[model samples]
Target: MSKRVHIPEYEQESELMAGEELVGGPAFWFLHLCWWQEDLRALVERFGADPADVDALSDRLTDDDAPWPVFRVPFGGGHTAVVALRNFPDDSGIDYFVHHPEWGRLGHLGQMDGHDTGPGLSWKELTAIAADVPDGAEGLTDPAERFLTLLPMLGDIDTPHDAAAVVARALTQCGIPPEHAPHIAGKILDNSFWELPSWVVRDGSPVPVCGASASPRAIPLAQGITAGQARDLAEALSGERKA
Candidate 1:
């Protein structure tokens, strides 16, 4: 299922200085996968190129030393729509656009705010180019839709090693000793969201409990404890007091 998201309103007239750079807009790996899918390939082919030849595309975009515009749109389920734009060398007053599920897009030079509708061109044109790219790719209607469309790609990753450290700290908050908490990963529901196998560790094994946010205010994974999860954690806390 696609996650629902909202775009934060920002000023439309912001601009970037010359020679500024925006890197990794189009989630590099996903761009590679688009090469194998026919529908997705058609979208890129419209620009007279093969998705398999990313180097060629990259080279062309950087030939003129122009700045790239990058954006990250957040969705509710730990997913963000990313895009960047490159300048159109052949065409006058046009730009090349790219997208990644989380990383971002490579879009036209000098169009940072995504609100310019210059002479019959809107920031959404490239999104419309891949509008029918399939596999929920058509969901790139707005910043939010684009984010939800890419949310599913994050569902199959292993827990990042760094989280173990954070989870260790989180355990300490519940009065559990971090040294005894030898940890493992949780299911990859969304790579962008953070959760552990459970904060409850018993007998040198993790007792899978759910619903606690390590940092309720951080990027990639910031959430709150659910009432039920909080209750379970409270029980664990009480157990700590008893012991």
Candidate 2:
């Protein structure tokens, strides 16, 4: 008698993994964890995928490791669409993920540029903040599964508690250290919406900004603001109390 394969169920679909290759379809974007690139790609390539712009996201992830910056990707066989930059696992040199939510139907944006980075700098506070973050293992939905899918980016929340369940669950899944789980969860919440640095150039060349409309169009439309100015603006928005 042949043994039955065991597959876990998720909110997305009741069906077990259609084998390993078809996992994380709708769950990659709002996923909360920091997954290094090399680990990600190896799993994807093992399943037979050719992704363009794989190195693209790798560059973006290495930088700041903010939320996710977006770039166009042609996956499997389709036109290039935007997906979270540099965060995916790319085994070969191909881009496997795209922004065609309709394909699997998940809402995701491709950048985290303008995250109101500089809030009052107190050495103690910075240290406190820096101390957060769990190990990578606890964030994966399937820890035992070697090829973890960093999918379905987690959404925004009004308070830390709202997102805590999701964060805690992810931490548990990935098996991150308990002491640092809250810290990692906090960063995940902070970076959930992705605020990119405006005025980025295509192919790494600067471009003029006509106006800002959040991404692609958000390259400093009005007079450029200094770092301090940007900080003030963020403070004002965050009400200083929360941020």
Candidate 3:
């Protein structure tokens, strides 16, 4: 009998790669962890699948042809949709795509642009944030959500806890000495988020912006604000709060 596939141990050396090729990477291990923590039957039901098919879908996780673990969402007119993670061409991030036999690939605009479409920074800023992400830190399951969480940090416009999370993630991803990571993260967090440089671009054609209904996670629009101006604003707003 074939051995059952199981979630692998988290390693400090793993890196991002195609989900299908994630075999032993951090993202792959994290995905397994998500599955473990989540209700499989509920997930299958949410995917519009019969609960009995859970085993079959789980089995497909290891199938090469299957690539990403996916589920079929039935649409009107006899069409079935497939939602899966696919590697972006630039290798900056992973994104989900909905595929239909006739309609082709349907992807989020932010996924295509490499940013969170929901009131977030652009791909460039996201990449800069990812650079700080160490190899083995936790909490990143949905790539889009992960990227979204960091958007506020780009503008230095977040609470201390949020700021610390970003710094800690970076420290962890870089494999900083575990003992030192928390200390460094705390120190960095002590700095005001408003003081950080504007890592996000403001001059790109059709610049990304937070809509009126944007989430709290979205960074406030850059509005051509310079780093020094942002620092000044941060100070003005906080009256020497230290961060």
Clashes of each: 13, 39, 9
lDDT of 2 by residue, 132-166 (tens): 22233111224222212222222221223555555
| Candidate 2 off by > 4 Å | 1-108, 111-160, 191-212, 215-243
Q: Which stretches of candidate 1 lie over 4 Å from their true place?
A: 1-56, 60-64, 71-80, 84-139, 142-153, 157-243
User: What is the C-alpha lDDT profile of model 3 across 40-153, one tens digit per residue?
Assistant: 213222223343444554454544333333322222222222223332234322222212233322312222123423323333434433333323433233333343333332
TM-score ranking, high to low:
2, 3, 1
Q: How close is candidate 1 to the true structure, as a TM-score?
A: 0.22
lDDT at 63, model 3: 43
> What is the Å distance of residue 50 in model 1 from its true position?
4.0
- Report lDDT per candidate: 0.29, 0.29, 0.33
**C-alpha lDDT (0 to 100) for residue 90 of candidate 2:** 28
The best candidate by lDDT is 3
In model 3, the Cα lDDT at residue 183 comes to 52
Candidate 1 lDDT tens digits, 1-243: 223222222111222222112212222322322332334433333323345556654553345454433334322222323443334354222221222233232221122223322111111221222232233332233432332223222211233456445433433333333343223111112122223222232332222222233221111111143444333323332232112
